[model samples]
Target: MITLQLAWRNLWRHRRRTWLTASAIAFATTLLVFMITLQLGAYDMMIDTSLRVFTGQLQVQRQGYHAKPQMRATVPDAQALAARLRAASGLDGVAARAQGFALASSVSRSYGVPVIGVEPEFEARVSTLPHLIKQGRYLSSDQAQEAVLGAALARNLKLQIGDELTLLGSGKDGSIAATIVPVVGIFESGNPELDRHLVQLPLKTFQEVFTMGDDAHAIVVSGPSHEAIPQTQATVAAQLAPGSGLVVLDWEQLIPGLRQLIQADMVQNWITYIALILIVTLSIMNTFLMSVLERTREFGIMLALGSSPWRIGVIVLLESVYLTLLGLGIGLLLGGGIAVYLHYEGFTFPGMAEIYAQFGLPGVIHPKLSFAGFTLGPAVIFVFTVLAALYPALRIRKLQPVEAIHAV
Candidate 1:
């Protein structure tokens, strides 16, 4: 306790230098906290936007369907399975979906695309497509032979609302499948895969046309948010009967390359953070070195009076500890407050609202302040600060009392 007091008093002797160094530390920490938390929030938004547009947060499918999607591989009794999963997962949004590849034809043009089947009312719980309709309306019944087409696909086939579109494909039973449905609606999802190649029909219509026998290829799921999906997915997976030949896939698995993209961006962020911390570390090191040089005679006099050289070195290190703790404490209070505000109130970029509207995403981005975000920055700074003090503290070991005392 006495040593700690001595170190604290020493800091005040060079009050201006200490304040400047501490201010630098606080500023750097604040920036790190805000940027890292903001970055995490942006990632959450990106995943939510991409999933809600069509893929959903989780999907239950045949074990091998995702690896090699064949029209014949399917989950039997889709609505019943969806109900069971919904009850077990405690998720509000669970919809059975059927999919098949077909060639769509209009009077003058034709294109090959994936045809999906959805339950109209249940689909709205899991998808934003019903809300993205730019023309006409979404399917109103489970058995409607009407279809909704993507904007790009409609343009490719020269199709418009109320136009008769014909679908041709091989059903699950290896028989010829044919259907003609009126285009009731068209959607622009802002996702190329969805916009360019997706076609939707009532689940019943798809089953009948695709010979799927009341079964669906996938069961779509939506949780309250992306963060809650893992728990929901685990609950759903556990409730499935053993050897059910089914698997639950989360957003990371459903969306290709998304995790890799986030990880790559995080690496870039850490690199920038490291560079900033290095600058702060160098500044603190300069302070410690100057303080040691200015107090050389005092240290020498103490040594001559029977104080060990190691004790003087210990004091220098303790001074570093005191300064670091002070700076870290103030930095965390300011930075953490900023992060908390962002997490709650959210923030909007100047013109992002319009862009969000175009993409059907929420206008504001909320930062997710996690434990990692809270500690990672401060921890790194503390470690670097200790390392910086080492150099100046070690110089005391090489000092000779007579030489140090007579030095100008």
Candidate 2:
């Protein structure tokens, strides 16, 4: 208790220096927490948006389909497979999709487009397509000879709801597949590529038009939450029919670009964090070194009065601990408050919607709060501050009582 009181008094004797050192640590801690929280939140948004746009969190597809998706590379009896997976645990939604390339034509214009066949009821539950409809209603299972056009596709072809569109493509067996269908809806996906060249039709219509029968390119699945995907995927993989060539892939594998983007961002962020911590470490060490030099005579007096070198070293460490704790408290309060506010209110960048449209990303970002973001910064500062105090402690141990007392 006496040693602690002495250490406490010694720290306050240099009030300005102590406060300055503590404030530096506090500032660094707050900055780290804020940046990490915001980055994590933005990543969450990106993952969800990318997954919901078209790719669900998990997909079951025929082998080699992801590498080279062709009409022939499809999951046979996909509706049966979907039914089996739907009965499994940890699954939130499941839908089958068939996709192909085709030329679309109207009375005035023609363009190449990617065509998608979907089950309206299940597709509505698994993807964002239903909610993204800008005009007209979504497709119904009974609605044959009707199609949906992306906003950009609609504009380029100069077609409107109730207009007829002609499609021409090759079927699964290299047969000529052609059809004329009425446009019933138009959707804006906020993705330039998707909006410009994507079309959707009823699964039954697509199978008949493309000669796909009941086969699908993929069976998309979604988990209740992001964290549940791995377990859900594992369970689904294990339960597949023994001779089935189907393979399960998570979003990280399906959309390698998204994973790569997050990894690259994280690497840059960690580099920045290391640099900030290094600067703060130097500042802390300087404070402790100056304090040791100024208190040389006092330490010498204690040694003369029979205080052990180990005891003096302990005092220096205690001072560091006190400063670190104080700084961490202040920093956590400020950073956490700001994170909560940003999490709820969100932030928008000017003209970001158009810019992000090119990359298929959303413009607004909301920062998320997590235990790692809140604790990592203060923990790093605490450990580094104690290490910085070690130099001063070693200097005290090496001090000669007679010379230190006789000097200044």
Candidate 3:
């Protein structure tokens, strides 16, 4: 208790230096807390926005279907399965889709494209594609003999709404699939990859034209948010019958490229965080070294008055501990308060939505607070601060009482 009091008093003895060192630690902690929170929040938004554009948060497909797609590789009775799963699973939406490659033709031009059949009602709930339409309207019924296509695809084929489009492909049972439908809608996704090669048809017409019956290539599903995906996926999987040749894939499995993108961004953030910690560690070491040098005479007098050398060293260590704790407390208070405010209110930019339109990302970014976000940065600072104080504390142990007291 007496040693702690002595250490605390000595901190106030050099108030300016003590406050300066503490402020450095506090600023680092606050910056780390907020920065990590922003990264986590941004990642969540990026993933969900991308997935919602076409690939929902999760998908149910036949085993090995994703590695190599074949017309024959399909989820049997997919529509019924989707209905059952939707009623039982606590998920936001579930829908079935049939996909195939076909040669799409207008009166003058022809091109190969992916033809996807979707449920209008459920698709509106699970996908943002329906909302991207720039001309005409989305499919009105599962039975409508109409199609929606990308603007670029329509342009490539010299098509416009109400124009006839002929589709020719192979059926799931190896039969020839052919159909002609009128184009009813056109969408511009802003991504050339999607804009140039995709078309959509009513599920019922597609099933007949492709001879797929009620089977579908994939079952698309979504949850309220990315964080709920794991639980939502588990609920759907549990309801599947034993020996069902079906598997559920989350966003990561559905898009390996997106996973790689997030990892690359995380590595960049870690680099910045590491550099900040190193700077704070050096500042702490400098502060403790100065304190030890200026207080050498006081330490020597205490040693001569029957205080052990180890006791004087311990006081120095305690002083470092107190300063670190004080900084940590203030940082947590300020940073956490600001983060909480942003989390609820959100931070936005005037032109960010337009900028992100090309990739389907959100404009507003909310800072998220979690146990890891709050503890990881401050914990690293505390460990480094203790290490920084070690050399100065050890100097007190090597002091000669008579020489230290009489020299200066």
Best by TM-score: 1
Worst lDDT 10-window in candidate 3: 354-363
Candidate 2 colliding pairs: none
RMSD of each predicted structure: 1.9, 3.5, 2.4
Task: Give the runs in model 2 whose Cα sits over 4 Å from its true position.
Answer: 1-9, 90-92, 107-109, 269-279, 301-318, 340-366, 390-403
Kindly list the per-residue Cα lDDT of model 2 for residues 66-104, writing each as its tens digit: 988878988998877887888875454888889988999
Write candidate 1's Cα lDDT for 18-98 as tens digits: 888888888888888778778888898888877887888889899989989998779889889998888877777999999
Give the distance in Å from residue 393's predicted Cα in candidate 3 to where it truly belongs: 3.3
How far residue 163's Cα lies from its native spot in candidate 3, in Å, is: 2.7
Candidate 1: count of backbone clashes, pairs at least 3 residues apart or interchain: 0
Query: What TM-score, to 2 decimals, does candidate 1 have?
Result: 0.94
Model 3 per-residue lDDT tens digits across residues 252-366: 8999999899999988988888899889889998988988888888888998999998998899899999999999898888778878888998867788867876555666898
Error of 3 at 161 (Å): 2.3
The stretch of ten residues in a row with the least summed lDDT in candidate 2 is 356-365
Better of 1 and 3 by lDDT: 1
Q: For residue 387, give model 1's deviation from the true position in Å.
A: 2.1
Judged by lDDT against the true structure, how good is candidate 2? 0.85
